[model samples]
Target: MFGEDSPEFSLRIFGDIGMHGDSKSDHSKANFSFGSLDFVISGSMGERLTFFSESLIEGEHADAIFFDQERAWVAWNEGDSFYLQLGMDNSVISRWNRLYNHGRWLETTITRPFLATFEDQGGVLPMHFQGLEIGGLLAPAAGDLEWVAIIANGRGADIEDRQRVHDDNTSKSFSTSLTFTPSSMEALTFGAAALTDIIPADLNSAVRNGSISEQIYDAYFTWLGEQLEWIGEYAWVIHHDGVSGSNFSHRLIYLQMAMPLDDWTPYTRFDLKVMDQNDPYFVPVDQDLDQWQQLLGVRHELTASSAIKLEIGFGHGQDRDAGGAVSSDDFISAALQISWTF
Candidate 1:
């Protein structure tokens, strides 16, 4: 138990060396980088009230570093049956976003699946928001059910705009998810979620002057056994452009599996994204793409608090130009990372 005056704190750091080769380019680039520095604080104010916060420092390059408050929330719990949280939190759209978060050491691979990537990193979905969350767990005759719902300031005019502190519009986003762990097969859990939001118009753009209506539907499952762990998730995104009076749909999916052997673990993952190229909301941000990637990695535990991971990935995608010309992007990459928690 932690006191309010003396909250528990933890720090995690990750660093890596990587080499990437583009099929179109004859030269391969290699660099060493600092991945992230994460700080976490938590404490209990009373028996039912608690507070938690997480901050991250990350580098875009050797000369540039940025700090972000990823999550900060105060919660009131009524045992395991119900809880209410208010503040900034990750959007509960998928299982991966809810499970791993920013804890690099907790994940088996060095990179997150495209489905769970951050918004600033070219992700299509809103990853974080300032919100109110209500959640609870229930035990039924056949299974244990868990549920979560959120209302928040959603996305802004741009894809990278998270609207963390202030909302651009009066319309709030809403999301809900549910998971069930059957009594007979406790190792498996499956869930589904739905989210809706209104994205403000990019007033600076003459072409995209109207708001966008966004809806996302997601489904995911996880199976954990003594030797093998497998996870899969799929999301369908629909957008309606107010100005053009057009509707577009996109799809994103990922599958990951890992095998643990003593101090070593091997993992593999596949990710796919298919988008409608004419979607104004995505076209302006250069996020409309048909892309896929395959990854293989191995992780070795050096100590209880540290691990080393080696990964290789192959990717292919299509790119569209302003004149509606299409191009292909193919790349192969390798990375080695060392991560530790303190």
Candidate 2:
């Protein structure tokens, strides 16, 4: 019989599909997807560290040889108050960003919160900072608090000047967060984080005239109980590049709740996002954007690690739509997901 200690190596296989109606174009395309393999290793070197990385091989970019992430890192435990980690690793800022694996079976929306996306705005922002981090518990109480700070190459993955104001430049991003688990008798915990990068003058080419660099300001919170959880975040961006109106502003607000009964859980969430197109530059061109989204979802847990889910949503453009005044795809989505771990 298989048990938790059957093997150290584990493999995970999963995929998600979304569609509307029964049309060829509408049914076959997926809004989000991923597949990967994993392994765990132990060595003669006392308390050797472990590592894991996932490459997106199917669903979104199915055929390309994409190295989406490479987190080959190691860590050493010094004690309860101190430890060290070296390699490419995700930042310690937001719970949603770090806890929500792509294969997770339950969520409030068909997509992630606007801030959770890894891009420039959401799809490719910095996910892993390649460097070293030293951190540990800062205080001991019924409700505990932990602290972390890292030194890394201030940019994200595969990003040239897009990740930071410089390309191949060496610098660091300083970040810290506080997490608390109150002494009260309730299943709840919360966290707050702040991050900033000091970029070099010569590498900052994004600015027009003066040698001002890039900056990021973020705050996040989460509360989870037996059956319900709440997540929220806010972020601000400041660019010191003096060309073409060297300023940028963006914000996000999301709220969601879920309840589970037996094997099924139903949920709903609302998202509001606003970005200034006039500052620094324009993406869609000539117009800023305000996006509003409403989502309703349900999930059926087949087991502790596997489940099936269905979701639907609608998006409204507050300003001009990039394609035209009318929305090109004001869509309704449905997805069936199956996930398991071994």
How many pairs of residues collide in each model? 0, 12
Can you give the TM-score per candidate against the true fold?
A: 0.93, 0.75
How far out, in Å, is residue 37 in model 2?
6.0
Q: What tens digits encode model 1's per-residue C-alpha lDDT throughout 262-297?
A: 999999999999998878777866688788999999
Residue 181 lDDT in candidate 1:
95
lDDT of 2 by residue, 59-86 (tens): 3343433434434466776665777887
What are the Cα lDDT values of the candidates?
0.85, 0.55
Q: What is candidate 1's CA lDDT for residue 339?
A: 82
Per-residue lDDT of 194 in model 1: 93
Top-lDDT structure, candidate number: 1
In model 1, the runs with Cα more than 4 Å from the true position are 1-28, 321-324
